[model samples]
Target: MTVIRINAITVPADSGDELAHRFAARAGAVDGADGFEGFELLKPTDGRDQWLVVTRWRDDAAFQAWLDSPAFAHGHRSESERGGGEAQRPVSSHSEVWSYEIAGGSPA
Candidate 1:
Protein backbone atom coordinates (compact mmCIF):
# COMPACT_ATOMS: atom_id res chain seq x y z
CA MET A 1 0.00 0.00 0.00
CA THR A 2 1.07 3.56 -0.61
CA VAL A 3 2.10 5.80 2.26
CA ILE A 4 1.30 9.43 2.64
CA ARG A 5 3.46 11.62 4.84
CA ILE A 6 2.43 14.96 6.11
CA ASN A 7 4.92 17.28 7.78
CA ALA A 8 3.69 20.42 9.37
CA ILE A 9 6.17 23.13 10.22
CA THR A 10 5.73 26.34 12.08
CA VAL A 11 8.24 28.67 10.53
CA PRO A 12 9.13 32.01 11.99
CA ALA A 13 6.94 34.67 10.53
CA ASP A 14 9.97 36.43 9.11
CA SER A 15 11.63 33.39 7.58
CA GLY A 16 8.68 31.46 6.25
CA ASP A 17 9.44 32.07 2.60
CA GLU A 18 13.06 31.25 2.94
CA LEU A 19 12.30 28.08 4.81
CA ALA A 20 9.73 27.00 2.25
CA HIS A 21 12.08 27.73 -0.63
CA ARG A 22 14.86 25.78 0.98
CA PHE A 23 12.59 22.82 1.61
CA ALA A 24 11.32 22.85 -1.96
CA ALA A 25 14.83 22.95 -3.34
CA ARG A 26 15.88 20.06 -1.17
CA ALA A 27 12.81 18.05 -2.18
CA GLY A 28 13.54 18.72 -5.84
CA ALA A 29 16.97 17.25 -5.39
CA VAL A 30 15.43 13.90 -4.51
CA ASP A 31 12.94 13.82 -7.33
CA GLY A 32 14.40 10.70 -8.91
CA ALA A 33 14.41 8.52 -5.81
CA ASP A 34 12.87 5.11 -6.15
CA GLY A 35 9.13 5.03 -5.37
CA PHE A 36 9.10 8.76 -4.92
CA GLU A 37 5.77 9.83 -6.29
CA GLY A 38 5.13 13.50 -5.61
CA PHE A 39 5.55 16.42 -3.19
CA GLU A 40 3.58 19.51 -2.39
CA LEU A 41 4.27 22.56 -0.22
CA LEU A 42 1.21 24.23 1.15
CA LYS A 43 1.26 27.76 2.48
CA PRO A 44 -1.53 29.33 4.44
CA THR A 45 -3.39 32.17 2.75
CA ASP A 46 -4.21 33.95 5.99
CA GLY A 47 -0.55 34.80 6.43
CA ARG A 48 0.00 32.32 9.16
CA ASP A 49 3.30 30.89 10.40
CA GLN A 50 2.51 27.32 9.47
CA TRP A 51 3.39 25.31 6.36
CA LEU A 52 2.41 21.84 5.28
CA VAL A 53 4.47 19.48 3.19
CA VAL A 54 2.61 16.55 1.69
CA THR A 55 4.62 13.72 0.16
CA ARG A 56 3.56 10.50 -1.52
CA TRP A 57 5.55 7.33 -1.90
CA ARG A 58 4.93 3.94 -3.47
CA ASP A 59 5.07 2.28 -0.07
CA ASP A 60 6.27 2.66 3.46
CA ALA A 61 9.50 0.87 2.74
CA ALA A 62 10.46 3.27 0.00
CA PHE A 63 9.66 6.22 2.20
CA GLN A 64 11.74 4.77 5.01
CA ALA A 65 14.61 4.17 2.62
CA TRP A 66 14.53 7.79 1.60
CA LEU A 67 14.38 8.87 5.20
CA ASP A 68 17.48 6.83 5.96
CA SER A 69 19.33 8.00 2.87
CA PRO A 70 22.17 10.44 3.04
CA ALA A 71 20.41 13.02 0.91
CA PHE A 72 17.61 13.41 3.40
CA ALA A 73 19.92 13.54 6.35
CA HIS A 74 22.13 16.09 4.71
CA GLY A 75 19.23 18.28 3.72
CA HIS A 76 17.81 18.05 7.21
CA ARG A 77 21.07 19.00 8.78
CA SER A 78 21.51 21.93 6.49
CA GLU A 79 18.02 23.15 7.12
CA SER A 80 18.49 22.83 10.84
CA GLU A 81 21.61 24.95 10.81
CA ARG A 82 19.96 27.75 8.88
CA GLY A 83 18.42 29.09 12.13
CA GLY A 84 15.10 30.14 10.68
CA GLY A 85 11.99 30.02 12.83
CA GLU A 86 11.47 27.39 15.54
CA ALA A 87 14.39 25.39 14.21
CA GLN A 88 13.95 22.46 16.49
CA ARG A 89 10.18 22.20 16.40
CA PRO A 90 8.23 20.32 13.74
CA VAL A 91 4.98 18.36 13.84
CA SER A 92 4.94 15.33 11.55
CA SER A 93 2.38 12.66 10.84
CA HIS A 94 2.04 9.58 8.63
CA SER A 95 -0.88 7.62 7.24
CA GLU A 96 -1.17 4.27 5.51
CA VAL A 97 -3.37 4.46 2.46
CA TRP A 98 -5.10 1.47 0.95
CA SER A 99 -6.26 3.29 -2.17
CA TYR A 100 -6.46 6.76 -3.59
CA GLU A 101 -8.15 8.30 -6.61
CA ILE A 102 -7.87 11.72 -8.18
CA ALA A 103 -9.77 13.20 -11.12
CA GLY A 104 -8.01 16.51 -11.31
CA GLY A 105 -5.51 17.69 -13.89
CA SER A 106 -2.70 16.17 -11.86
CA PRO A 107 -2.31 14.06 -8.75
CA ALA A 108 0.30 14.72 -6.11
Candidate 2:
Protein backbone atom coordinates (compact mmCIF):
# COMPACT_ATOMS: atom_id res chain seq x y z
CA MET A 1 0.00 0.00 0.00
CA THR A 2 1.04 3.56 -0.56
CA VAL A 3 2.07 5.59 2.45
CA ILE A 4 1.06 9.15 3.14
CA ARG A 5 2.56 11.57 5.64
CA ILE A 6 0.76 14.64 6.84
CA ASN A 7 2.70 17.28 8.73
CA ALA A 8 0.32 19.79 10.23
CA ILE A 9 1.43 23.10 11.64
CA THR A 10 -0.27 26.01 13.32
CA VAL A 11 1.25 29.45 12.80
CA PRO A 12 0.26 33.08 12.87
CA ALA A 13 -1.41 34.59 9.82
CA ASP A 14 1.75 36.38 8.87
CA SER A 15 3.85 33.27 9.23
CA GLY A 16 1.68 31.25 6.92
CA ASP A 17 2.73 33.30 3.93
CA GLU A 18 6.35 32.97 4.84
CA LEU A 19 5.97 29.27 5.27
CA ALA A 20 4.33 29.02 1.88
CA HIS A 21 7.19 30.83 0.25
CA ARG A 22 9.71 28.54 1.86
CA PHE A 23 7.75 25.50 0.85
CA ALA A 24 7.58 26.71 -2.72
CA ALA A 25 11.32 27.12 -2.85
CA ARG A 26 12.03 23.68 -1.46
CA ALA A 27 9.15 21.59 -2.73
CA GLY A 28 10.69 21.11 -6.16
CA ALA A 29 13.91 19.84 -4.65
CA VAL A 30 12.10 16.77 -3.46
CA ASP A 31 10.68 15.99 -6.87
CA GLY A 32 13.56 13.75 -7.93
CA ALA A 33 13.74 11.80 -4.70
CA ASP A 34 13.23 8.07 -4.92
CA GLY A 35 9.77 6.77 -4.19
CA PHE A 36 8.38 10.27 -4.19
CA GLU A 37 4.86 9.78 -5.35
CA GLY A 38 3.45 13.29 -4.89
CA PHE A 39 3.28 16.32 -2.59
CA GLU A 40 0.82 18.98 -1.58
CA LEU A 41 0.86 22.13 0.52
CA LEU A 42 -2.61 22.54 1.91
CA LYS A 43 -3.50 26.03 3.05
CA PRO A 44 -6.38 27.09 5.20
CA THR A 45 -9.52 28.16 3.30
CA ASP A 46 -11.92 28.80 6.17
CA GLY A 47 -10.08 31.63 7.90
CA ARG A 48 -8.02 29.24 9.96
CA ASP A 49 -4.28 29.30 10.60
CA GLN A 50 -3.52 25.65 10.07
CA TRP A 51 -1.45 24.23 7.21
CA LEU A 52 -0.88 20.69 6.13
CA VAL A 53 2.16 19.44 4.31
CA VAL A 54 1.26 16.19 2.66
CA THR A 55 3.65 13.78 0.97
CA ARG A 56 2.99 10.44 -0.65
CA TRP A 57 5.44 7.60 -1.04
CA ARG A 58 5.44 4.17 -2.54
CA ASP A 59 5.59 2.46 0.85
CA ASP A 60 6.90 2.63 4.38
CA ALA A 61 10.35 1.63 3.20
CA ALA A 62 10.36 4.44 0.68
CA PHE A 63 9.28 6.96 3.27
CA GLN A 64 11.97 5.76 5.64
CA ALA A 65 14.53 6.01 2.88
CA TRP A 66 13.53 9.62 2.35
CA LEU A 67 14.02 10.35 6.05
CA ASP A 68 17.49 8.86 5.84
CA SER A 69 18.41 10.54 2.56
CA PRO A 70 20.66 13.53 2.05
CA ALA A 71 17.76 15.40 0.54
CA PHE A 72 16.04 15.31 3.89
CA ALA A 73 19.02 16.85 5.60
CA HIS A 74 19.46 19.41 2.88
CA GLY A 75 15.84 20.35 3.09
CA HIS A 76 16.02 20.97 6.81
CA ARG A 77 19.61 22.15 7.12
CA SER A 78 18.68 25.80 7.49
CA GLU A 79 16.54 24.96 10.48
CA SER A 80 19.38 23.57 12.59
CA GLU A 81 22.13 25.84 11.33
CA ARG A 82 20.61 29.08 12.60
CA GLY A 83 18.91 27.36 15.52
CA GLY A 84 15.58 28.09 13.88
CA GLY A 85 15.17 31.47 12.28
CA GLU A 86 12.24 33.67 11.28
CA ALA A 87 11.25 30.93 8.84
CA GLN A 88 10.42 28.77 11.80
CA ARG A 89 9.49 31.45 14.28
CA PRO A 90 5.81 31.71 13.51
CA VAL A 91 4.92 28.21 14.57
CA SER A 92 3.36 29.67 17.71
CA SER A 93 1.99 26.45 19.12
CA HIS A 94 3.35 23.24 17.68
CA SER A 95 3.32 20.87 14.77
CA GLU A 96 2.44 17.22 14.42
CA VAL A 97 2.54 14.46 11.82
CA TRP A 98 -0.28 12.13 10.95
CA SER A 99 0.50 9.12 8.78
CA TYR A 100 -1.84 6.92 6.83
CA GLU A 101 -1.77 3.99 4.43
CA ILE A 102 -3.71 4.32 1.24
CA ALA A 103 -6.27 1.59 1.63
CA GLY A 104 -8.69 2.97 -0.91
CA GLY A 105 -9.40 6.23 -2.65
CA SER A 106 -10.89 7.84 -5.73
CA PRO A 107 -9.19 9.89 -8.42
CA ALA A 108 -9.97 13.55 -8.56
Leading candidate by TM-score = 2
What is the alpha-carbon RMSD of candidate 2 to the true structure?
Answer: 3.3
Q: What is the C-alpha lDDT profile of model 1 across 1-108, one tens digit per residue? A: 566777767666766667676776566766877998888888877976667777788887888899899877666754556555445544332323233333355554
The TM-scores, one per candidate, come to 0.65, 0.82
User: Candidate 2 overall Cα lDDT vs. reference?
Assistant: 0.80
* Highest-scoring model, lDDT: 2
Give the range where candidate 2 is weakest over 10 consecutive residues by summed lDDT.
82-91
Q: Please give, for residues 1-87, the per-residue lDDT of candidate 2 as tens digits.
A: 678999888878878777887777666777888889999999999988879989999888988988898888878655535366444
Model 2 vs. true fold: TM? 0.82
Q: What's model 1's TM-score? A: 0.65
- Screening candidate 2 with a backbone cut-off below 3 angstroms (N, C-alpha, C), the clashing residue pairs are none
After TM-score superposition, the amount by which residue 71's alpha carbon in candidate 1 deviates from its true location, in angstroms, is 1.7
